[model samples]
Target: MSSLSTRFWIEAAREEIQDWENECSYCKRAKSKSAIQIMAPLPDIRLDMPMRAFAHTAVDYAGPYITIQGCGKRREKRYLCLFTCLTSRAVHLEMAYGLDTSSFLNAFYRFTSRRGVTVKMNSDNGTNFVGIKGTFEETRY
Candidate 1:
């Protein structure tokens, strides 16, 4: 731009640069989101629940992290099923050997056995959670 300025005076140079910037793919990609994000109201479980650690909880799966078992070099992928108390902000981590409903059920049973039955549970509609939901629905009269 400094060298170009010596050749001729650019009228509305700022506007011209902005126009090019707006059209440039790299510039457009680099720009941060301009719209303000509106957060939803906090769920009742977070506010209205009793102070018990596992009274109401939110559930999510973390990852299929690599693990080595036994005295061999055998490695297996395992997921972490995270259970978080809404009001108490307490977290309980459970290892899930697989993403299947049975695996999650085992982990869930372990959690229930230790923490007792939760009054309410929140999830992000994950596939494993969906499968467990269907299982519960089927068992209900």
Candidate 2:
């Protein structure tokens, strides 16, 4: 008693024409909204006086030098240098081994504990500075 074709049955059951529009998969995938519009330019910063006006500091680390005669045979030896101020460019340096978070923090504490507080301090994105996740806490002093 069933004489109707599969296509005729599907078309009758759909009840809407919107489902049959734009059958191309590529066209649908390629189509997207317009690109985002640009806003105003970033603001410029101005300094009233020279860089020396602010207590600025720069920090860097040097060397994992090879073992030397008379020096201990340790693989973690390194030098940490901190330069401060612009006029005199006062610098502080210390020798350390095992560049882990505790060692770095101890060295920094020793330096700052003696030299006193500084207004600004800058250092490159090193493991000692940024620290690894779940290994060390960020210092704020």
Candidate 3:
């Protein structure tokens, strides 16, 4: 169990323990060993793209930088809405005024107007994104 090959030692220890139950008192315990096995990898689905850029897209929010208004003392936080094409890796960035649904919708509008509607869009599971998910669902129905 103390060997540098932890997996091997673990399997060895497990087998030894199981064998201990069936062994007589006069017999020495057997060591259990594990071997590494190769596994077939899953196919890459991105290769089957529909021959169009931005058809499959991913979105994510970037920042919360503090920025002062034009010649004003007040500071405001800013966020970025990033849109990326899954196939071509083309990227589109839109500034989000805030993390609210309205701000996200505005950014989404700008992106769609420029790049056309996406058949599928992926986003991180952030609360702001979740809010937009509800908005999309509501608009769909």
Candidate 4:
């Protein structure tokens, strides 16, 4: 249909044919022919844990959004420090003033003080986290 339509005098025939081909079911099935299927789902280990909150935790840094300063017409960048319990799936959020180690430590301290010391913590290889981890290691030693 595309080649036949292009042979005629229809305006934008190639673009219309391309659009129709994109939404066509035959094109979709052709595209999925080489796809692979997943064999099985991974094991769920969250059910075997004792009734403890934040025993295993995953921590991540979120965003840097603008916030109003106190009693003044000023906007400052703030980030979210997220702490998630692996077993209970509970989340704790803390505001970070900046992406520095001090701010992250303050948030972490607040979380630990409230939720108790976590047994395990998982985080990505962000630079601020790397610094914080190094500082904690030094203090432990």
Candidate 5:
């Protein structure tokens, strides 16, 4: 269909993609006729832990959902900080006002006050998370 509509043939497009070596790796993978062999999921010992709720926690931030800031016509984007327990599969949600360390700390405070201290936490290298890591380390020391 694309070959009929566009000026170039499908083979030409494939050849063009092959010319860009970086893109061809992905294109070649997509064009392969063989059935995909997916690896089985790896097992984690932490998930099998006999522990209390919110013990082994994983923290991540979601979206910048638009919300009304104050009383009037002012609106602001907010991010949702999600805390989940690996062992119990329990979840806790907190609304963060900003992506800064202070805002993240406020949400962290709210989470800890409600759920208590967590044994382990896993999260991606978001700047907010990285900033607070030093604070947590200092407190521990």
Candidate 6:
């Protein structure tokens, strides 16, 4: 075998090499010939809805009950709630000692100053919405 040409040795050993590879436990256990591939899903689109058909608003609270760090007033903490319009996605922000009338008014004024007059405004009805007056018609839930 040592005296044979390299080409001849390779040709002669090909069948034995294939047989050894098939019978070897490590090669059989570690090698794989087939695989499955998966793809991610796509987002859905709604064709019927026109963009910015009506002014949409969403309000959410940003904190739990607590006091201001340095003010030293013994009371519940303040919450920062934001109101956003869905159509234009315009935003209004207010910070309140408690979700009270004054805080809502402050946020409303800030929003109105930036976005101008909106025909409709939307927000969740908490105590902030109670007895509240505004120029824009409100749709509260």
Top candidate on lDDT is 1
Cα-based TM-score, every candidate: 0.67, 0.46, 0.61, 0.64, 0.65, 0.43
Error of 3 at 101 (Å): 1.5
lDDT of 3 by residue, 1-141 (tens): 356465564557767865865685544333434669997863354455776788888899989978899887989999989998877889999999998888988999888888887788877777777877766777752
Residue 61, candidate 6: Cα error in Å is 3.0
- Give Cα distance to truth, residue 108, candidate 3, Å: 0.4
Computed on alpha carbons, the lDDT of every model, listed in order, comes to: 0.88, 0.57, 0.79, 0.83, 0.82, 0.60
Better of 5 and 6 by lDDT: 5
lDDT of 2 by residue, 15-41 (tens): 343343356566556665578989775
The CA lDDT at 134 in model 4 is 64
Q: Model 4, 18-123: lDDT tens per residue?
A: 8987899998777676758986753354444856899888889989889989886999999999999888789999999899989999999899899998777778
User: Least lDDT summed over 10 consecutive residues: which range in candidate 4?
Assistant: 41-50
- Model 6, residue 68: displacement in angstroms? 5.2
| Candidate 3 residue spans exceeding 4 A from truth | 1-45, 138-141
Query: Superposing every Cα of model 4 onto the true structure, what RMSD results?
Result: 7.3
Give candidate 5's root-mean-square deviation (CA, Å). Answer: 10.5
C-alpha lDDT (0 to 100) for residue 57 of candidate 5: 81
- lDDT of candidate model 6 versus the reference: 0.60
* 4 against 6, candidate with superior lDDT: 4
Q: Provide the lowest-lDDT 10-residue window in model 6.
A: 42-51
Model 4 clash tally?
0
Top TM-score hit: 1
Stretches of candidate 4 off by over 4 Å are: 1-48
**RMSDs, each prediction?**
7.0, 12.8, 11.2, 7.3, 10.5, 11.1
Candidate 6 per-residue lDDT, tens place, 61-124, comes to: 6776576465776566777877766654555666655666777677666665665544554455
Instruction: Find the 10 residues in a row with the least total lDDT in model 2.
Output: 42-51
Clashes per candidate (backbone, < 3 Å)? 0, 0, 1, 0, 0, 2
Q: What residue runs in model 2 are displaced by over 4 Å at the alpha carbon? A: 1-54, 66-76, 132-141
